[model samples]
Target: MDGAIWASAYGCQGKAVASSAFGRPSGELQARADSPTPAGIRQRSGAEMIMGQGAVPIIVGGEVVGACGVGGGPSEDAEACAAG
Candidate 1:
């Protein structure tokens, strides 16, 4: 995958893993929305969610330690490679 896609995939997976750990599916969005800001400033919404099917969280001792994302091939092939 290209660097941009790789980075985006990693970021998305990280956020998802974090949300799963916290048991809040919208934790990232909620936090971004709830942040205090200047009156004239408006927080942006509708952020694109780029999820790479090949990415999976690495769990250790019942906690998510890290993640791995693979791209550049068919989604299922990438996922299978990552799974193995």
Candidate 2:
């Protein structure tokens, strides 16, 4: 199944980031940025793993300067399986 791209840009307080879905990232990253739900957090799995689901946090002087992310969607039971 096709997945949606979710991203976030962080700047001290943090915010959403905008990026193309063409690039493949990590689901965990994206879920944290987009959906905070249990399902969103545990989506994607295996070779069929969904793309754009990870986060990149910017740190400066032991502080979180910013962060970026990408991912979300309704695929198969991969997320459920992964969660289990």
Candidate 3:
């Protein structure tokens, strides 16, 4: 999958965000809301979520082939970068 992370002090956070993308259709914000667990989906999945944005499915031919995660600051900027 094509993705990029900018200036994250926690290296794993970037990977976590990217990987989390594949698990859901909505971004992190919605992910938390849709979580069936109380500890939250990320915690259940064994990753600490620092931010709530960026990361989306790369759909092709009506199927999700991969994902794109542009994690940096706010969800909007990251999302825009990913979309860009």
Candidate 4:
């Protein structure tokens, strides 16, 4: 599957944004407002999370601007896991 697609689908946007702002590669963020944990929803969060690997932030000019998470699911694990 596509890592970007999964990340987009699993609410990885926040993580990506945080990564970009913090200049860190490893980080966690809630996908939804009702989410119980910011890290993720646990086993019920879906294959994208249950089997997910890691999230990597995209930094620009010493600041996080976005992120690219890899692994943890078929869609995002095509190549390798990008840990944040």
Q: Which predicted model would earn the best TM-score?
A: 3
Alpha-carbon deviation at 16 in model 1, angstroms: 8.7
Number of clashing residue pairs, candidate 1: 0
TM-score to native of every candidate shown: 0.44, 0.24, 0.51, 0.36
Q: Report how far off residue 8 is in candidate 1 (Å).
A: 9.7
Off by over 4 Å in 4: 2-8, 27-53, 71-84
lDDT of 3 by residue, 1-84 (tens): 134354543533543354344544235554454455523655665654433456555677877666556554666676666667
Q: Pick the candidate with the highest lDDT.
A: 3
lDDT of each residue in 1-84, candidate 2, tens digit only: 134333312211121121112222234344444454423433431122223334344446866544444224332232332223
Residues 1-84, model 4: lDDT tens digits? 343444454544433443443345433332332355533443344423322224566656866666675443543342235541
Ordered from best to worst lDDT, the candidate numbers read 3, 1, 4, 2
Rank list by TM-score = 3, 1, 4, 2
Candidate 3: the clashing residue pairs are none
lDDT computed for candidate 3: 0.52
lDDT by residue (1-84, candidate 1, tens digit) is: 444454545545544443343333322334443345411122232333323344455667978666554555565655555557
Worst 10 residues of 2 by lDDT: 11-20
Name the better of 2 and 4 by lDDT: 4
RMSD to the true structure for each prediction, in A, is: 8.5, 13.7, 5.4, 8.0
The CA lDDT at 72 in model 2 is 42
Error of 3 at 36 (Å): 1.4
